[model samples]
Target: MAYVLQSDQRGIRTLTLDRPEQRNALSDALVTEVDAALEGAGADPDVRAVQLTHTGTTFCAGADLRNPPDPHALVALMRRIVALDKPVVARVTGHVRAGGLGLLASCDISAGGPGSTFALTEARIGVAPAVISLPLLPRLDRAAAARYFLTGEKFGPEEAARIGLLTLAGEDVDTALAPVLDGLRRGSPQGLAESKRLVTATVLAAFDRDGDDLVERSARLFASADAREGMTAFLERRDAAWVW
Candidate 1:
């Protein structure tokens, strides 16, 4: 099967990640497909909104560091999504972390199942939040994000909604997404597109203005031994002594 699958229903385009055995981790190929899928949905007049989802237990486990992704590539795609002229909603069902959190935050809306928890583990991996921070900022006020970003702590569904990272935390994402989708469907498609445009333009312009510095800073953190150790420890099923 393909790394990513794109399907459209009633003008809603859903891009699903197909790499489950690997915890739906983002490989370069998957990232490429993500970019392409977003590009196609953004351009399709019939697609009034884009829904991002995945198959399997782990919604996404971040980057497949064995082959690791170029942070810039995924970051750039996020800028595109934030700037796109349509609403993007994330339908999450399971564990989501790191770059996966970036994808979720980039979406204008997110609905998660009861089991969902969101975390940013870059610092734990000896890396900075980078692009994930960019999307996370506008929604989660700076202070809360800073604490979560630095600690690599996992927060649950209600906390996610309280933090503004998730719009709905229901027993199942489908129930929450249903009403939100209907609301969007009721609006003028042109108006919805334009509203998205205005929001994206504002956010993307700001991102462009300060994005480089942040990315560079994150790169420096990524080179740290702690980040490498933490990631390695997690993969090896051991505790990470961040104090060391």
Candidate 2:
């Protein structure tokens, strides 16, 4: 079966992640399929917006270790998401964790069900959430988001939406998604394209100017004695000391 299922409705192409048994883990082929779908949506003149959703209860559980995701591939996918020609909305139904949460953050609009959960879970698995941080950082309340990043706890949707991780959170996902799509319909396609380009360019410009600074910031954490301790504790099934 195809890993990705796509359909276009009212100029909005919604891509459904089809791997319910694995909670939609991004295996190599899954990522490739997703990227290809995104590319197709971008090229189709009839597709003015896209919605990324999953078939099962969870939006995604992140990448599976059995078919670990390559950093390069993930970077390319996210870059495309951020640079897509049209607006993309992430329709999350249940838990969205780790790198999957990164996908939510990169999209232009995000709508999810009530009581859904979210987490930056890499800290619990002896890894880092660096992949999603670029897109997530801007959306979070600096001090509050730090708590989850350091401790890796699953937080309530209320808190997630309150802290800006979720743009819409109430009722079933479809309820919220309907209005977002309706609103997008009134927007000028050319205007959306120009606006998206300007916004993406602004963010990219800042990152480009601070490329060295980002490297420095990341290097410091990787070299930190505390980060090593945290990863080791996670791997050893011990409690992390930095719980916030």
Candidate 3:
């Protein structure tokens, strides 16, 4: 079954994460499909905008620990979204966690509903949000990043927006996103490409410089005994040994 679904309408390409059964977790296959779709959208001249949305109550439940994605591939996918010539907007109406927030931060704009909750939950699983930090660190306020990254606390849409993790939060996120999508559709392709470049230059540089190191760091953590026990505990619906 396809994990990601693709469709185009009125010059906008929409990529929907379709793995609702898994809460649209970023499994290795799903990550590959999403990256490929973004690349295809960038190359297609008829596509002016891209919408990254998901179907389900949970936007994404972070990585699929059983079949985790390669750290290098995940970082490359985030960079692809950041560097894509056309504007990418995320329509978030559900919960997001860990690497899912990386996907949101990589987008040009993200709008979420009040139902949307977010958390940097990697620490709870005995790993740092290393690969995701490439996009998230730049978008999030320093203090907010430190707090959430360390605590693994869940926050709502209002706090997400306040912390710069979301561009906007509203009662109806899709309705709130319409105007922004309309504005993007009106922008000339060249103008959008150059403007995005201007805004993302720093992120691109960070990706180039630190991407490999972060990938290695993530792999090391995932392979650790702590992560194994934490993930096992989570799957078994029990507390990890360290949890008191």
Candidate 4:
């Protein structure tokens, strides 16, 4: 089954996450599909904007824990999103967690419904949000990142917006996203490409400088005994042995 559905309308290309049964988890296959789609959109002259959304109630549940993705591939996917020349807008109407938060942060603009929730959940699995931190740390407020990264607490869209994780939060995410997409569609392709470069320069630089180390860190943690036990316990629907 296809993990991502792609369609183009006007000047916008929309890539809908289609793995609702998995809550749109970022499995290796899904990440590879998304990367290919983004690359295709970036290279298409007719595509002026990209809209990212999901089919399920949960936007993305992060990596599929049962078949955890390759950390290097995850890093490459995030880098592709950040480096895509066209403006990428995330229309979020569902929950985002762990690596999903990294996906959201990489977009140029992200609009989410008021009920949408978010969290950096890796800590609960005894692994840090290492690869994701490349994009997320730059986008999130330092203090907010510290709190959520440490606690793995769920928060609503308002706090997500306030902390710079989202560009807009409203009762209706698509409604809020329309004007932003329209604005993106109106810009000349060159103008939008250059402007996005100006905005994402720092993020790209961070990826260049630290992406390898972060990927290594993530791989090491996932290989650790604690992370394996925590992930296993999570899948088994029980507290990890270390949890007291």
Candidate 5:
């Protein structure tokens, strides 16, 4: 089965994450598929915007521990979303964690249902959210980022919105997105592209300046003894060695 399902309507291209069994985790193949889908959407003249959503109660569980993609690939994916000329909007209905939040941050707009939950959980896995921080740190509230990054706490959609991780949260994601999508539809491609470029300049700059360093940091952390133990414990359904 395809890792991503794509459809276009009313100048909006919707890309649905299809790995419900894996909570749409960003495995190597999934990352590659998503990047290619985004590239196609950007090149399509009929596509004025891109909508990213997922299938299942968990929107994305960050990385697949068993098949994590290259840190550089993950960084590139996030950068592509920010740099894409058309607006990229996230319509989230479940939970998002770790690297998944990076995707949210890279989008031009993000709306989550009230049922959605979010977290930056890399610290718990004995690694920092290094590559993702390129997008996240620039977009998120500093205090909120520090708190969740250190504690690895899960927060609701309201809090995610309050901290700039989401544009809005509502009881129904599609209903909330109606006006936003309409606005995007009404915008001329050039107007929307220029507007997006203005807003995402800082984020793209972050990727340009710090991306390589962060990818190296991420790879090093994932290879460390602590991360190995943490990943193993998580896969085994147990606490890491330092967990009390």
Candidate 6:
């Protein structure tokens, strides 16, 4: 079964995450599919931009604990979104958590509806939001990042925009995204690519410099005794042992 559904209209390629039953979690297969779709959009001359959206109420529930992708592969995917010559925009109107925020941060622009809620949940699961911080820390408000990354508290779309996790938030995601999509469609191929580079340079630099270290850190954390207990507690619908 296809994990990603792809279509193109008016020079914009749309990639929809299709694992609704899984809350569109980032399984290895889904990550690979998304990466390959992005590659196709990047190479197609007629594709002026990419719009990444998803089906279901949870845009992504972070990594699939049962079948998480390699940390290196996840990092590479985030970097690819940042470095893709064409602009990438995320249209979200659902819950996003943990590593899913990393995906949102990597995009050039992201718009979410009022229904959207976000959280950096890794800390609650006995791991730091390490690899994701490559794209997240570069763009998020420092104080905001510290607060959410450590506390794992959920916030609304408005707060997500205020903290730089979302470019815009509105009552309707498509309404907010229409103008941005129009802008992309109007931009010349060279114009969009060059302009995107100017905005994403810092993010790409973070990926290049810290990517390897973060991947190792993430792998170590996931393998730790604490993470094992936390994940086990999560799967069992209970608080982790550390929670009082």
lDDT of 1: 0.83
Clashing pairs in 4: none
TM-score of 3: 0.98
lDDT of 1 by residue, 1-244 (tens): 4788888788888889889999888888888888888898878878888898888988889888886777788788788789888899889999998888888888898999987877887776667777677887888857778789888899998888888889889997898889899888777778997888776776787689877877777677777788778778878878788555
lDDT per residue for candidate 3 within 1-244, as digits (tens), equals 7888899889899999999999998899999999989989999999999999999898999998888888888898999999998999999999999899999999989999988999998888889999899999999999999999999999999999999999999999978998998899899999999999999999999999999999999989999999999899889999889997
The whole-model lDDT of each prediction reads: 0.83, 0.78, 0.92, 0.91, 0.92, 0.93
Instruction: Quote model 4's TM-score.
Output: 0.98
Task: Give the TM-score of each candidate.
Answer: 0.92, 0.84, 0.98, 0.98, 0.99, 0.99
Residue 94: error of model 3 in Å?
0.7
Model 3: ten consecutive residues of lowest lDDT:
64-73
Candidate 5: segments with Cα more than 4 A from true spot: none
Residue-by-residue lDDT tens digits, candidate 2, 1-244 = 6999999888889899999998887788888899999999999988879999998877888776567566557666777888887998988877887878877888888877874788787766555777567677777899877898987788877788889888888788788788889887777889899888876775455444553554455456546777677656755788777655
Residue-level lDDT of model 5, residues 1-244, one tens digit each, is 5999999899999999999999999999999999999999999999999999999988889999999898888988999999999999999999999999998888889999988999888888799988888888887899998899999999999999899999989999999999999999999999999988889888888899999888888889999999999899889998899998
Clash list (residue pairs), candidate 6? none
Poorly placed runs, candidate 1 (over 4 Å): 241-244
| Model 6 weakest 10-residue run by lDDT | 198-207
Query: Lowest summed-lDDT stretch of 10 residues in model 1?
Result: 123-132
Q: Please give me the total number of clashing residue pairs in predicted model 4.
A: 0
The total of clashing pairs for model 3 equals 0
Misplaced by over 4 Å in model 4 are: none
RMSD of each: 1.8, 3.6, 0.8, 0.9, 0.7, 0.6
Each prediction's number of clashing residue pairs: 2, 0, 0, 0, 0, 0
Residue pairs in collision within model 3: none
Q: What's the lDDT for residue 54 in model 6?
A: 95
